[model samples]
Target: MSVNTSNELRLIWVYPDLLSTYGDQGNVIMLARRAQLRGIAAEVVPVRSDEPVPTGGDVYLLGGGEDRPQVLAARRLRADGGLARAAEAGAVLFGVCAGYQLLGEEFAGEEGQPVAGLGLLDIRSERGEQRAVGEVAAQLDPDIAGEMVEGGAPAVRSLTGFENHQGLTRRGPGVRPLARTLTGIGNGDGTDGAYHDHFIGTYLHGPVLARNPALADHLLTLVVGHSLPPVASWADRLHQERLNAVLAGKTRPVCKVQADAEPTGTRRHRHHAPGTCTTSPR
Candidate 1:
């Protein structure tokens, strides 16, 4: 069957068994709702054991999981680099929690071993003994972070979410953060989040997309290519306003403990204004 243009965003959710932490499935529903609001159809494909990863999806989501699941999922993904190729093709890939950890070249588990990654993004994760959990507040880069702010296009209705992770991801050869962890940054070494091209990886939880509609729109834009507009129409505005109101109820205060914990500058890379691209730190 030919793809319908009205709702033509293809999404692939890889390894639910090895992924899916803290109700990550909610993310799928949230994304679909946003797509429907914009009058676009979204197709979400799930990849399990021994399955060949599909190509040409508008976006990919990888969620968090435990040690056993992470090992199994990593093995499956590393055996074939199809996801890497699709990402190289400019497909928007969003990895969260365990999903975020899998996108890196490797993650160092608790035993201090390097687990294989899809090498889709320039970062590495090392497992930690403790889990980073609690509500978080973050300052996003204006250019990339603005749309998610309140009252902005594709606005983020909630500024807080649960961050649950046991490892920290260090910036490898390339990658900037989509948001920072106010406390540990999820990168065991105390880095926040990382970004590369259209790829965004983070440890934040509570169906993050539901709280960050602008991010959902950004992902949808990648999924549909730049052809479709966001849900900015009158009807969409009404829907979003209602959604924002619902989110207001769920909004929690950012953990004050991490507030003063500015992420340590691991690299002396020059800072550039938002929107402009900077080379990944050395």
Candidate 2:
């Protein structure tokens, strides 16, 4: 993936029909709006599971999904071959929750069996006995800070979002932890996400990009190959609010062991897992 020399940015949102359990699609919107705000022409391409994924996107995004759907998505993505090719060619890719799990070598299936994944990141996920649900925040790894401009917005030290997952992820030598866990069960080992090369995977999903604009900008910078001019302060205030709340122990709950009944709207995604409430931090 060459540095975006042109003014337009091509972004691909993969498997929306199958992998959009959370409002994680907002991640795509966040990237696009942020780029467009900076005077870059941003084009978002949505690829359904049945459709062919284009391999020419500068960046790609994958969101959360359920057990069966995730299994199907992994299988179909392998057959599609476009995403793997794009990654192999150095496209920047970001995935959250089930999408993150599927980017690894394997993740637990609905029956507790291991299922093959897209193998984009050197990580693995296994189903834990208990579901993890709550607000989460983390201090971004210094490595992430190292990539930022010398005087850019103080280098985004911490990140905040919501998380709901049953899989405990372990990072392999090929990747590094995206951040150190500050609150909530991310990766179940005090690490929040995994990153290697241009691929990033995470469990946090208040549409994680929405809560952490610096990260969104990081991806944009990778594609654009330069430090972008700062846009606004509103996202910084929002980030600080969540970070301060989590640091002060405001662990807002997004799911319980059992929800009495599903809400009428999109919150229905919360009812997918059995025996306990599970969702994409919608």
The candidate maximizing lDDT is 2
lDDT of 2 by residue, 107-208 (tens): 999898999999989988888778878788777767875785432534787878888889888778788888776666678665678898889989996378
Each model's TM-score?
0.75, 0.86
Off by over 4 Å in 1: 1-7, 146-152, 155-159, 182-185, 188-191, 225-282
Worst 10 residues of 1 by lDDT: 268-277
Q: Write the per-residue lDDT of candidate 1 for residues 42-121, one digit (tens) a residue.
A: 77787775788776676778888887788788887777676777777777888887778778888765466888887878
Model 2 vs. true fold: TM: 0.86
Model 2 stretches astray by more than 4 angstroms: 3-6, 150-154, 252-282
- Candidate 2 residue 165 Cα shift, in angstroms, is 0.8
